[model samples]
Target: MAEEEKRASPEPPLPSPPESSSQPEHPPPETSTPPATFDPSRMIGIIKRKALIKDLAAAYHVECLALCRELLELQKRKDEPFLDTKATEDLRKETLRSSSKRAKKKR
Candidate 1:
């Protein structure tokens, strides 16, 4: 325990700067770069556009699921509906393949 404590202890502090050194008495004051002009209308437009895109994407997914559900319902009613099981399996495989690639690495 004593050996571990010694090992964990920090090193000595560094020496302070000397006062004898004759540095500049008064260096010129630093000038700040001006801030960019604000546009309230433009900012509002950008926010609205982003929200619209999000809503559109959500609506698209909902529509796709609704369509798929309708097709399933139709198939259930008909004995021999024209639904391609192979295409469904292929889509599943493709989705899994892409997901596996993403899973191997952290974003």
Candidate 2:
């Protein structure tokens, strides 16, 4: 049996930089912007304000619908009793027609 001796290969040399250029070098990007800190109080106030506005908007919508119904009823028969079935039917029809028209307009 013959024994073979193994030789280690030499490592590759690192690449050299190119010759200096006449152009002015630009600096690396700056990332010194401070991270935004959380303000719990301000956040809570904003959330509260948003919730209040949303609730007010919802209330306003309900009030507007009721007012519209009432106005339609009043315009239909100024002196008629509110307990009359005909007035109620007219108000319902007006409300439904107005709502459908608004929906169509939106689309």
Candidate 3:
């Protein structure tokens, strides 16, 4: 039985950079926010403000919906004549006839 010995291959080196940039190889340190301290008064004030904003928003929403409905109704009315065309025409003719009769009677 013949024993064969395997040669270990060498890994290629990384490409060299053209210029040394100002940037560091490692990323900049993360900015950390200050730890929050529990304040009952501040929390209560925030909750109250949030509730007030919600109430105001709801009121405005209702008002906006009302305005939208009014606008839609007005638009629909605009599409329809205030006095129907046939009725108005008949009324105008009747008025003219009545006026002519009154003028004849005055004569």
In model 2, the runs with Cα more than 4 Å from the true position are 1-37, 78-107
- lDDT by residue for model 2 (4-102), tens: 332344558889987588645986677898777898988999999999999999999999999999999878786566558778999999999988875
> What order do candidates take by lDDT, descending?
1, 3, 2
Give the per-residue lDDT digits (tens) of candidate 1, residues 12-76. 88898776657677876777866668989989999999999999999999999999999998877
lDDT per residue, candidate 3, 19-106, as tens digits?
6688788887777966789989999999999999999999999999999999999987986785578688999999999888755555
The lDDT of each candidate is: 0.85, 0.82, 0.84
Judged by whole-model lDDT over C-alpha atoms, candidate 2 comes out at 0.82
The Cα error of candidate 3 at residue 101, in Å, is 46
Query: Best candidate, TM-score-wise?
Result: 3
Give the clashing pairs for model 3. Answer: none
Give the Å error, residue 95, model 1.
42
Question: What's each prediction's TM-score?
Answer: 0.33, 0.35, 0.44
